[model samples]
Target: MSQTLRVLGTSVTLLESIRQRAEAELGIRLQYQVHDTQTAQRIAVMHPERYDLYDQWFHNLDFVWPARAIQPIDTRRIALWDEINDLPKLGRLHPDDRLAHGSLPCDRLFVQPDGRLGSRPGTQISMLPLTHNADSFAYRPEHLPAALAGREESWSWLVDESWCGHIALQNDAAIGALDAALALQASGLARFDNLGNLRLEEIDQLANCLIDKQRHGHFAGFWSDDREASALMLGPRVHIQSLWSPTLMQLHRAGVKYRLAVPKEGYRAWFGGLSLSRCVQGPIKDAAYAYLNWWLAGWPGAVMARQGIYIANPLRTRDHLSRAEWDYWYDGRPATEQLPGSDGLPLIDPGEVREGGAYAQRMGHIGVWNAVMDEHNYLVRRWGDLLRTAR
Candidate 1:
């Protein structure tokens, strides 16, 4: 009899292809409940018993870890733990690379002897770091003002009054607040001591500035998922906005002429991985471990790489990708020929190069990571006010 592993996460990793592959290879039945970031976090924190594993971001640990919703993963159980790169293990690919601000995965990776999460190395981990990338907004070059066509792309553009009424932002509070803060700071409208974690006054001041913009019709709408983001970007409703890697691939397949900006300020990065639900044990727990191991395996990482995410074990993933894919996506070289996405559809043009260059260069430029702020509760309420007032 096959034991069912109930997995909860966003559509990014919980794809139909992945589910089918896992069941066929691991001999376990799988059940997936995919939700947007906000809803998934709410469920994982409040009702941990409903799922066997939680596939989400590291920043989310602030909520789930404190709620005791997840169990630490033993490194020995991870088949390819030794092969994993230093980025998640040490918080930087190279020792000299400064850690990006926010809730970095390494900062909360290990399980301390006292049963709390910390950066110091240990045999147990809060989550197995998997797919990750540096994120920035994209825009349709043709839609931009002619004067700005040759100018360097920037986060400040998100706040520029010239682009007001045509901009959109991702709707989640934590991620969106950081996006807005970066924009505000870049445009010289506001300053923050730390972009990742906002103080109470910073939250209020940021919200007030955004609310004022909302009254003047600064935003078209806020999107909670890729579908809404795609709609806003594809239609004439929005010219530019915050975007994820997968959404960019979708746009490429649809033949949208968009530019994923290499922002002057730097990218807002994120790391996504899987964690064991607190209630999972015995055979179900073993199956859960198998799933985590499967993610680090070559094929799965290749699938995610087609959409621009970098797997934690890059060398293993490199084997599964074609030379053109390796050159274009990882090495930052122009594509020798059109490359196919995970769905087998052409996603890259022959002469096109990735926006921010090679993996090392791109990862080195991270400004702030997606985070759960210290004043997250207050931020949420104020964000809600911004949303309500915007509509």
Candidate 2:
């Protein structure tokens, strides 16, 4: 009998494509019910026993635990759980490229192939990495910031004194945390110094910049939503901010011009990978594994690239790609078939992704990052307060 796989995925624009892929894989076609993340969370909790797998933005790992709504993953039962064969290939995946299997974060205390890892919240040997990416500058105009500095182009220039207040940034920590960390890193103001864990001081810097720019009448304001950011940039209230490719692609479809930049110091990013659900039964698990392997090998990456959304699996090579295709896939080249000006040419040398200095996968680690950033929200709220007080 064909086994059924009940999975949850984000309702982002990629929903349709992801659904089609699952249908093709399961043969029986998955019962994919799309909902906002909140609804998905409720479904996961109410029917943990019923779900074969709960697909989410990896950030779901944060709530998965506190809500106590999941089954323990059966590592021994997973048919493809070959350590020697899979771990090396997966473990060696670019640290930020946590979207692949077999890799763990910094060997921290988790139920991983290595041993008990650290205290990074739900990452305690639970959950799995699904997809990962580095946050970089996505812009148009082709005026490379690093080049203007007599340096290579970079997304980090938005944080510099020269740029002052005109910048774009994502409000979601998972999406924009790395970009904040890099901006702070450039100013020597931010680092993983807090608790020796990767940290980002996003709010303070943003507030200060907001205040500074207001004082000089040079600041435009930090963007809180992707659509809003794009609109502002289109209206030209904002010129730049860190953005992921999916949104950039949509903007391109809207006829907005821009490019993606993997800065010299490296772009900051977070990623997730797929792990079979402990609740899954029947041959579906093997099929899921097949899908996972295929995804890891790069079908999803290629598809995402076509949509201007970059996924992690570097080895996941696409078939019959032209130079323009490669640009959109690996080099941040624009989807030239549409956005002719956006040829997302490489701005700087970010080194190879296979090496370290890239993003590290933090499976089931949404809570830790959230707790840290929640305190950071004081700054965000404070920015609002400042605008209010001024009025």
lDDT of the structure predicted as candidate 1? 0.91
Q: Over the stretch 239-346, how does candidate 2's per-residue lDDT look in tens digits?
A: 666665456655666666565554665544344444345566558766555555545444555555554443443444445245555654455433455222122333
Best by lDDT: 1
* Best-performing candidate as measured by TM-score: 1
lDDT of 1 by residue, 1-391 (tens): 3799999999888888889988999999999999999899999999999999998999999999999999999999998999988888888888888888999999999999999999999999999999899999998888887757788888999988878899999989989989999999998999999999889999989999999999999999899988789888999879999999888988988989999999988999999899999999999999999899998889898989898989999889889999999998899999999898988788888999999999999998999999988889999999999999888
Count of clashing pairs, candidate 1 = 0
Task: Please provide TM-scores, in order, for all candidate models, with all chains considered together.
Answer: 0.98, 0.61
Candidate 1 TM-score, true structure as reference:
0.98
Per-model lDDT: 0.91, 0.47
